[model samples]
Target: MAEHAGAQKGDVICFGHTHKPWHREVEGIHFVNTGSVGRPKDGDWRAGYVILEMSGDQPRVEFVRVEYDLQQVMEAIRQSELPDDFAEYLATGGIPRPVESAADAE
Candidate 1:
């Protein structure tokens, strides 16, 4: 995530962490979030991506979410040693709501 400090409308910034799809322009700066490829938080539960088209000095952005065999993905998670919570995230978009801490579970 290149902050660039002072980004303009024509200047775009790309980043992903919240796993939520988003595209907005504020203070003449373009902000884009690609979400996730395997697990998304946008409640669509599909692979998400962004397409940026630069026409001259201006730029066009598009967000895309692709659906696939989620069953296979869950299977892979089950086979792996990853935490069960991860599977839950994949099953229900990104991280499960009401995030419970380890102490809370205890």
Candidate 2:
């Protein structure tokens, strides 16, 4: 994955997953994950985003957290005719447990 991102001896790379935000240099390349916006299940309530600046000799990384209207999302969900349980989970942050797989039967 790192090679595919064009990361060489001195290149910058940025990627996001796992709902974690970070900024740092690896092997002379800068890598960053902007974190998650919707389900920032992390302890912090603030949603995550990232910014980069290359004007300076060294790249700059900025992480910003902004709050939006969650109720509007709920209201939209209400109008979508989706299942009530789904909406309830969104409003309450109560994730449903996943069903066990046969591989786990051992």
Candidate 3:
């Protein structure tokens, strides 16, 4: 996909929306996925971000993860009238647990 982005050599393209963090270089074009800062779907509950440093014609990229009070966020969602599944998604890092039916328990 980076090749189709019309990036030339030594060009860096940073984007994030999928909530999955990733970085790669294709044909001298640097592609970076900055990940998510709040609702991360990369199997990591922590906040994800990136740091880009450019010095003297060189560019550096750094991926950062931060931990916060997930319980508090989940509690807020639980109290708001949002579906419980939302909290579950945050707790599980986008992997939703299968809801067990009462009959299945028996």
User: Model 2: residues >4 Å from true position, as ranges?
Assistant: 1-10, 78-106
List the global CA lDDT of all models: 0.76, 0.67, 0.83
Return the clash pairs for model 3, or none: none
Worst 10 residues of 1 by lDDT: 1-10
Which is superior by TM-score, 1 or 2? 1
lDDT of 1 at 85: 70
**Candidate 1, lDDT over the whole model:** 0.76
User: For residue 98, what is the lDDT in candidate 2?
Assistant: 68
Candidate 3 per-residue lDDT, tens place, 18-69, comes to 8988888766667888988877887898877899987765579889998999
Better of 1 and 3 by lDDT: 3
Please report how far candidate 1 places residue 47 from its true position, in Å: 0.9
Overlapping backbone residue pairs in candidate 3 total 0
Q: On a 0 to 1 TM-score scale, where does candidate 1 land against the true structure?
A: 0.72
Candidate with best lDDT:
3
- Lowest summed lDDT window (length 10), candidate 3: 1-10
lDDT for model 2, please.
0.67
Query: What CA root-mean-square deviation does each model show from the true structure?
Result: 4.9, 6.3, 2.7
What shift in Å separates residue 56 of candidate 3 from its native position after superposition?
A: 4.1
Measured against the true structure, the TM-scores of the candidates, in listed sequence, are: 0.72, 0.58, 0.80
Q: Candidate 2, after superposition: displacement of residue 61 in Å?
A: 0.6
Total clashes for model 1: 2
